[model samples]
Target: MGEIYVDGARCQGHARCWALAPETFEIDEEGYGKVIPGRENSGDELNVRKAIRNCPERAILERSDDEAPAKNEEVATS
Candidate 1:
């Protein structure tokens, strides 16, 4: 039940997020990775967490429902 967002500035077209969570992320035509529209807040449990940790660019960010309006640092670096 966590929420994920991909930082376009940090994303260098690496599809690691997509590879780790296809159902939650997708690579755009330009090859940059993005969270699938509605799936950004999906319940991936482990895959999405892996995506966040495995992202070489550290582009993928997550915030739990309880952590609103907080910075990415507020969220644990799973």
Candidate 2:
């Protein structure tokens, strides 16, 4: 299985992640993005991919369970 993460440093509150996957992503008070707990693996790979690809900041990422730690400064996961 794969996991989704939101890079806090890279997130610019563009909301592309939330727009593409509302159930998986959310915008915080500061307008930055956060991954909704337990929603990252909602089995909606297509939308997740869309969120990842559409992020202007490239903040959304998908990593396989066995993959090494993500490169983001801060990784938010469900």
Candidate 3:
């Protein structure tokens, strides 16, 4: 599982992260970023990276375990 974190103070209710990866994140009714329960450490590299890149506030962060990070594999451009 990959670790993901949301800096609540930095979130601006943009919901970009949710839009990018609905399976991984959601915006609360109060307009702050919240990680969907049990998704904090999901190994969905593609979706997680997409959310991080799409978040306008840059509030999202990822952490990998002690193991070496994954090598870059080609992903098709949308």
Q: In candidate 2, how many Å is residue 30 off?
A: 1.0
lDDT of 2 at 32: 88
Candidate with the greatest lDDT versus the true structure: 1
- lDDT per residue as tens, model 1, 1-78: 567788889999879888888988899899999888878676466888888889999998776556545555557553
Better of 1 and 3 by TM-score: 1
If ranked by lDDT, best first, what sequence of candidates would result?
1, 2, 3
Instruction: Please give the distance, in angstroms, between residue 74's alpha carbon in candidate 1 and its true position after superposition.
Output: 25
**Alpha-carbon runs more than 4 Å astray in model 2:** 63-78
Better of 1 and 2 by TM-score: 1
- Native-to-model Cα distance after best TM-score fit, residue 74 in candidate 3, in Å: 40
Query: lDDT of model 2 at residue 31?
Result: 86
* Residue lDDT tens for model 2, 1-78: 356788787888889888888878888898888889877565357887788878999877666655635545345542
Which candidate achieves the best TM-score against the true structure? 1
Lowest-sum lDDT 10-residue window in model 2:
69-78
